[model samples]
Target: MLKLFRSAASIAALILGIAGVFLVLYAWRLPPFTGTVQTTDNAYVRGQVTIISPQLAGYLAEVAVQDFQHVKAGQVLVKIDDRIFEQKLQQAKATLASQQAALANSEQKRRSDEARIASSKAQVDSAKAALTAAEANWKRIEPLLERGVTTQSQADQARASLDQATAALHQADAAEEVARQDLTSTLVNRQSLEAAVQSAEAAVHLAEIDLQNTRIVAPQDGRLGEVGARVGQYVAAGTQLMALVPEKVWVIANFKETQLAGMKVGQPVTFTVDALQHAELTGHIERFSPAAGSEFSVLRADNATGNFTKVAQRVPVRIAIDPNQPLAERLAPGMSVIVSADTSTAASDVPATGTAPGATPPAQVSEQ
Candidate 1:
């Protein structure tokens, strides 16, 4: 009876061992996976904060905004001592007025020159008519002198009168030519003065722009932060006086290179920030860095050394959150967030059978 019992026990042990082996083999055939990267207690929120500075240097006169104040776009943030700017603007206006007057005077002078030219042309015509009459008189006297009907003295006087009239006519013609040249030159001078007036006007416009800039205004609607300037402070150009935090904010997650295998653009991402434990925000993967984080470092690691050990790289992935969240629950930039993207969505979104351009068709199942 003891030998029979030992044989039955041996058979039972063999059957149990075979069953365990089969279970191990079955578990090995499942899909591969790894533990997700996450953090429950550590993270930071971050976003873009614009540095508020003056484009022009001046003494700060009035600080229009208080610390941590909310401001709308184009609201006056600060007022520099605009006294100097105002004086400059006044001086520019005065200069432009002066230039405009000069231009008007130049135009008036040009008109006067034109009038002189017209009068000169009339005088030239009168002189030409007088010369013609004198020549005819001299011709009639020549016929008389040839017939001895006119005395030599009379003929000589007539010739002298004709010469005098010719000289006067030539003088008038020269005067007319001078007047015409003067008119042309005056027109040119008027055009030049007009150009000067235009230039002066441009200077005035620039001065006005500068004056407007003296009243510093917010470029966008944002929250005020880090108010470093005070009333009566002398701020230089490009000096930072405060900071403006915009309402828009999002998260940047650095994921392990191995974790990105299933990560893809447009994948749905769920994030948890340490500060707001109860707040769950949904975002989508916008993009991932093409290169590893180490590659972008100033001194990248050289793996050429034979003694070097391999390390998995981490890549930066940008995830944008839904914009429809409540104002109270909006995420601020630089806030740490634990991110998880579901790449399995690609399976349903992608066509299973149709082949995309430049891609091979997916495998089709066959009924066996």
Candidate 2:
């Protein structure tokens, strides 16, 4: 009986030890114990950080907001010296007015030329009538002179009168041509004046744009990072004035390639922020990186050159945070977080079939 009891005790202890090992493996999701939940600590909040710069160079006249101050769209953040821009606008307007006046003057000159042309035409008509009368008189006088009915002097005078009438007609035609030419020149000058007016108007518009740019305003509703400008400090064009961080932010999780087999867009995700006391937040997988993280490295490895040892590559997954969450609002770019995606849900669009393109052959997946 003592030998039988010893054997039974040994069997019972062995069974208990095996059960404990299985339990530990199940808790850690190892091998056969793995499920559809994929998790990674390689996650961070991200946002569009925009750098504010000046479009024109000038001295800082005013700093309206302080560092980290929340601002609305179009709210003035800083003011540059605008006196020069204002003067330029005024000068442009004056130039525009001068060109317009010149254009008007050109119109008046055209009208005067038209009137002169009409006067010239009337003189031409008069000359034609006079020449007709003079030719008739000369013809009558020459016949009378040959018959001895008129004096030689009178015949000579009639011929001379005919010549004078012909000269006067030629002068009238020349005057009319000159008047038409003057009108043509005036019309051409008017076109040049019109172009000048357009150019001046454009200059005025540009000056107005520069003047408006003097007041640096927030491009969107966001918070300022810092105030780098001070009164009387000169800044050049494209100089960085500050940084703006919009309220919209999301999380990026770099999960191993092997873990992406069941992952898909729209999978429910939960994350805990280290900055917010590990407060849990809910989100959904928005999208996946087109290529593995290794593809984006500055110095990519050439596995073909070296002895190959297969290692799993990480693929970035973008998760969209659910709105109206109190803790989600506190999340900022660069904040670390642990993200978990529940892949058991109805599968949506998966990013990769097996190994993602540009990624190494996936290694055996184990919860990292």
Candidate 3:
């Protein structure tokens, strides 16, 4: 009876050992217990975080937002001392007005010069008529003096009148030429004045732009981080005032290269957020990185120079988180998550090349 009892106990122990081994295999999904879902712990939540900064230098007049405050697009976030900017705008306007006045004055001068030219032309016409009459009188007097019908004194008087008329005509011609030159100069001066007006107008526009820059506004609807600016604090151009976190976010999963053989865009995905008590969320495969993770590193390993040991390379896969989930709003950038892709349901027609058709290449790939 003792031997029989020992045999039964040994048999039960062996059966239990076999069951434990199966359980371990099933948990690890190895051999007969393999699954179609590919999973990786190297994943994180990411969003576009915008750094807020000023484009100009000024003392802070007002900080309109608190830390982590929700803001709307174009909402004023900070107000710089705008007194100087206002003054500058006014100065530019004054300059523009002065230029315009100069242009108008030039127009009036142009009209006056035209009138003077017309009057000089009329005078030239009168001078020409007088010279013609003087020439006729001189010719008649010379003939009479030769025939002794007129005295030498009469001839001398006629010659003197002709000489005076010639001198007068020359003076009138000179005056007319001076008047025409004056008109040309006036027209040229008007062009310069018009150019000056345009230049002043441009200056006014630049001043207005600077004034607008004094009021730093939100570029989009988002939540602002801590405000680094305070009342009366002087800040220069490009000084970071705060950070803006947008509402749109997604997940990045770094999977082993071997796992990418079955993965494709639009494949169903599920991820568990570590921050939210491992709550599972649904998503889909959005895109694949163009290169492996090592290619983006600041210092890359050179296999030719060093002892080569083969290591599995990680490829970043972008996952789009589904909207309207209650926990999705709570998700923030930089949160750790575990991602799994269900490749079993992937369409057979879809190529597993990891890139979508007709998609533009991204400028940069995020490793995290």
Candidate 4:
């Protein structure tokens, strides 16, 4: 009976050892067993989130949209107390009108000054002509007096007339100088008036901008988030009013570096969203992050100063949803997901090496 028991024990040990060897062989990807594809649940849906904030400080007069309400781009989402803004606009317009009126008055003054200058110039010409005639008469009379052809009194009278004409010419010159100076001053004043007008115009423009700010509009077509703002709520500039989640969404998958050997852009991907039951979505690899996920961490690991251990770091891969097979229309961001990538086929249609035509190196993204 002892010999029989020993033989049975030996047979049992041999069978168990044989089974262990087969399991190791299978785990090691030996013959008769294929390697499983890389898969992970470290993925999520992501998109741009718009944070609506007030650009100007005012009391909220109206809140047009509610939480989860669909809004079209450029639709009015909120209205601030516009009375102040409207008054500012009206004052700015009035100032602009007054400035324009002043400018018109300056223009009229400029014309009047020009006319005065022209009249002064004519007077100077007339004075010059009279001086010329008086000097000619005095010369003729002086020669006549020397030749005894005219009396001394007549020559004296001609001399006095010449003197008078010279005084008149001097007065004309003084008047012309005054007119020219006045004209110069008027031109300078016109410049000041024009500047005032421009300033008023700028004020009006700023007022209009403020008025437009009173009516906040949605920037994109999306669903509204929690409506934290309410009517009569006093808010300051840059205050958060609400949020918007856009309709377009995509997946971000972090895959282990070891599993990235066969991953490439344009390769098909299958993922299941946690929010959806018994449903799956299909997409294609869009791009790969230039660095591993740890690189973006706030406190990144510094292997240079620490004892190093081999770690399978994960890299972020951007996967674009096939527009036709995108997540549900109501799906939002931050949703959890599981991703599976097939390595059996290559994406020959795309430049998986990140060297597409006209594409810059990954480092250029930081610069952009």
Evaluated with lDDT, which candidate comes out highest?
3
Tell me each candidate's TM-score. 0.80, 0.83, 0.84, 0.87
lDDT of 2: 0.88
Model 2, poorest ten-residue lDDT window?
359-368
lDDT of 4 at 233: 98
lDDT of 3 by residue, 189-299 (tens): 888999999999999999999999999999999888888989999999999999999988999999988787767777889999999999999998888887899999999
Q: Which run of 10 residues does model 1 get worst, by summed lDDT?
A: 33-42
- Against the reference, the lDDT scores of all candidates come to 0.75, 0.88, 0.90, 0.86
Q: Deviation in angstroms for 193 in model 3?
A: 2.5
**Per-residue lDDT for 9-109 in model 2, tens only?**
99999999999999999977777889889889999999999999999999999999999999999999999999999999999999989998988888899
lDDT, candidate 3, at 57: 95
> Residue by residue across 170-239, what tens digits does model 4's lDDT show?
9999999999999999999999999999999999999999999999999989998898999999999999
Cα lDDT, model 3, residue 346? 45
Ranking by TM-score: 4, 3, 2, 1
TM-score of 1: 0.80
Ranking by lDDT: 3, 2, 4, 1
Instruction: Return whichever of 1 and 4 wins on TM-score.
Output: 4
Off by over 4 Å in 3: 1-35, 347-368
In the order shown, what is each candidate's alpha-carbon RMSD? Answer: 8.3, 6.5, 4.7, 3.8
